[model samples]
Target: MNLSWQTRAQSIAQMKAETFDILIIGGGITGAGLALDAAARGLKTALIEKRDFAAGTSSRSTKLIHGGLRYLEHYDFALVREGLRERTELLTLAPHLDDPLEFVIPIYADKRRNYDHPLLVRAGLFLYDLLAGKYNIGRHRRISQAEALQLAPQLDPRGLKGALVYYDGRTNDSRLVIEIIKTANERGAAIANYVRLVSFRKDVNGKVCGAQVTDELTRESFNVNARAVINATGVWMNEVRSLSADLSDDDKQLRPSKGIHLTVSAERLNVTTAWLIPAIGEKRFYFVVPWEGRVNIGTTDTDYHGDKDAPGAVQSEVTNILQAVNAYFPSAHLEPSDVISAWAGLRPLISSGNTKQATTAVSRKEEIFTDRDGLISLAGGKLTTYRLMAERGIDLAVEQLRDHFGVQAKPVSTKQIILSGGGIKRVDLEAHAHKIARAENVSIETARHLLHNYGTNAEHILALTHEDEALKQPLLADLPNIAAEVIYAVRAESALTIADVLTRRTRIAMLGAAMNCVEKVADLMARELGWSEEKKAQQIAAFRAEYEREYLIAR
Candidate 1:
């Protein structure tokens, strides 16, 4: 399972021979976590996805690894505790990818807000710190109105009572997903992206034994068998449910809600700390987070009524975000022109009671349903608690496999294992980064960027530089990433399209605010990878279209 995207060819070959012990669907955080869990438990496992890894809602999150402080308002102690515990684990396991971030929530007067907002927020942060225990980054503190203004100059000064400051983890959400997939591959989980689950194959006993899959890029079809199949598809769970004809409407367990985000330059929000604004009439709070030199200000939770694959961030929703942020940060009055980019994602929420009652009232916890037909589906978990979701999903699948195959499997051991580049133990990460740069004859800045992004695996790209010095040159003249990385993503990460490389593998298109630089990379990639002229044209067109879709504009 050397979980690199390249392993799909081998997994597809192996699937043609016989059935695996467990087959997991979805390739986002939960699905990736499940694959790693199952493989580590000594269960012969494989995972498949319909799109690139984290291409869905997983990549378009607020990118916070907090204990859900707002959940404390709703008294969801269990969910908060579990999330707190997972946050500690993720920080310890992937330090290079996850780091501590300070946040401020200002108390505004005349807003008809709670008088004890500071104390309430303090209590939540205290509990969050307590749960993190030895792994906690820092404790919560209170700042005077003047101090708050000094920290965030753009914040509205009028009627400012005080602020509650706390620390939480921030991460590159998509990179974390990719690392999990790589770790699962290291543990023997065969995972592939751009592979769609077409239908289910049942055995003589009417149990789901495998799935019929179609390669979205090549349009080729194949069959793979498994003792137990798990559908971890986020918003697309109903499609998998429909594949099994015997499953009825009752089998559909998802009610997806749309979460939209606006990407703006980090300069717009000059504040260094992430800010949380109390919602005027909603249970939710808006977050202004920093990521990759940009401010990922989002998001608005609302009931979705549209296609999950091509969901658009309507102008009305964009207006809501801008209005809310402007209400707090008067100096940084943002408009549509300030938007570098925007995106919408469908959270595959489990439909239990009235999902429309209150957007904040909906559960953020996951639900596991093992049907009588032996198809296991896990849905409705937050990005913070994906590992727990995976552990439960794999635990259930193992029970089904042991009973069916008459063989025992090993216990899960992912809790203590370091993944991919995280396996490298470095006392001085900065010094190590410089060493790699000197060895590769690349600049220290370039080396530091790579080492931070990929940890020890940065050496792989450097190795390519030694073979071809030209590969060391940057893809775009101004970008830090080089051609070696683009080639590595295509050849090693199993990226099938130019958008996959620009959007996920390198994140150039999103950061640069257009595909102008990325299109040039795509053309260079086309020549190096031996892509047909028509193929290159098609990729360029697709890249432009996706840019328009995410930015909410028509070309």
Candidate 2:
């Protein structure tokens, strides 16, 4: 019953053989969440991904479990309250994966930015805290200019009018998706990546019954017969909806927007807490947050019309982000060279689905629409609200299953089910990290890194490290990850490619450390998966291409 990585063939075989109660297309966060929720309710569910899980927009996010603080400006209190509620549930659901982090919003008297007025910012924070109600981690407060400078140190001091500190939950976007997928698999959902949906299988009335899917890995095609089919592909939902052939609507479904985020050395642009710097003249703001040992900093939202598969930040975008960061933290003076890695993802804001005229007005509220062929497609949501999105999507599908399709489904609250690698309620994570540090003879940083990434399941990795001394060797001096992580990825986490292992499974690539130890990682994966020299070489080349595709800012 191996669900990931080594079980690709087995998983595919089961998918081809079984007639599923629900078939999910697109393996991003939304699809992954729907799969988990449906399976938990005892539905025979199968999910397929054309590329990899979280390979699209899911993997590329600002990585925050937002409380929707920004929505306060438009007086969208309900959205704020909903996001804050989800934040509370997620923290309890996966503390190791999602945790509270402080944010500093520096105010400058010289530059009139959005919410620059101390009283105004404080009012918004007050609403933000009030909205959180019982779930609030900490109340937002106005800090003295001296205190603000003490916290950030690098913030531009001229005309500084103090700052306001607030709290929000940050996450590893890709890892969270993988965790949910694994949890769903544990609850009995047939899942496979690198499997493309060729087209929808429809009945005489053109209602989708299932789909014709291809194994991208083997170039093999098969028919998956399902009672209900879901399009949870996020940005690609429009393209997926087009698969119904006759189910065509000229009215565009999604108003796609591209956002790019870049990471740099913490030493280069240091911050203990996340910084929410207001992008001057722009109503929205920018985030320069501390992640691992680096600062993840853009996310300029603009209408995107380009290749959806591989979208990278161009030279100007990169320069713009760097320039903004430098303005906020003049002392840092970060250059393009300081950018370790950069990547972009398109937001699936549904055009026809949106009630608001402006695209930004769509925000994170998700919309679900059923095609004439009975294909359910979801669009326009953010990572923070994914769990609720899944719960709602499953609720609709379950109702359709019973009333429309004559199948029975009674959904239980997913809020109760702890995600895979979670459920360490009583144990103190910090204390555990210290204990593992002494036991494994590794630094506290390395121990904490493992615990945060893998949760309680990190024990398997620790055991591997103790079993083999060489497995304990760190991949890079800057990165606390070890060779055991790569081995664990292949054996457990469905890391069929070097990019999956480095980029998402362990996040070694995000830190700009993956390329440094590609040979070692490849060797470790080969040993576990039994790859030949030629195959390994091809994998390496593919990873190199992906890395460049993501990070190479065309000048």
Question: Among these predicted structures, which one has the highest TM-score?
Answer: 2
Residue pairs with backbone overlap in model 2 = none
By how many angstroms RMSD does model 1 differ from the true structure?
2.4
TM-score: model 1 vs. ground truth: 0.94
* Residue 289 of model 2, lDDT score: 83
After superposing candidate 2 on the true structure, give the runs of residues whose Cα lies further than 4 Å from its correct spot: 113-116, 245-252, 353-358
lDDT of 1 by residue, 383-489 (tens): 88888888888888878777878857786567787767775544556888778777777777787778767777787778877788888887764557887887777
**Clash count, predicted structure 2:** 0
Model 1 spans with C-alpha error above 4 angstroms:
1-6, 113-116, 245-252, 281-283, 424-427, 434-445, 477-479, 512-514, 553-555
lDDT score for candidate 1 against the true structure = 0.78
Error of 1 at 382 (Å): 1.5
> How many collisions between residues are there in candidate 1?
1
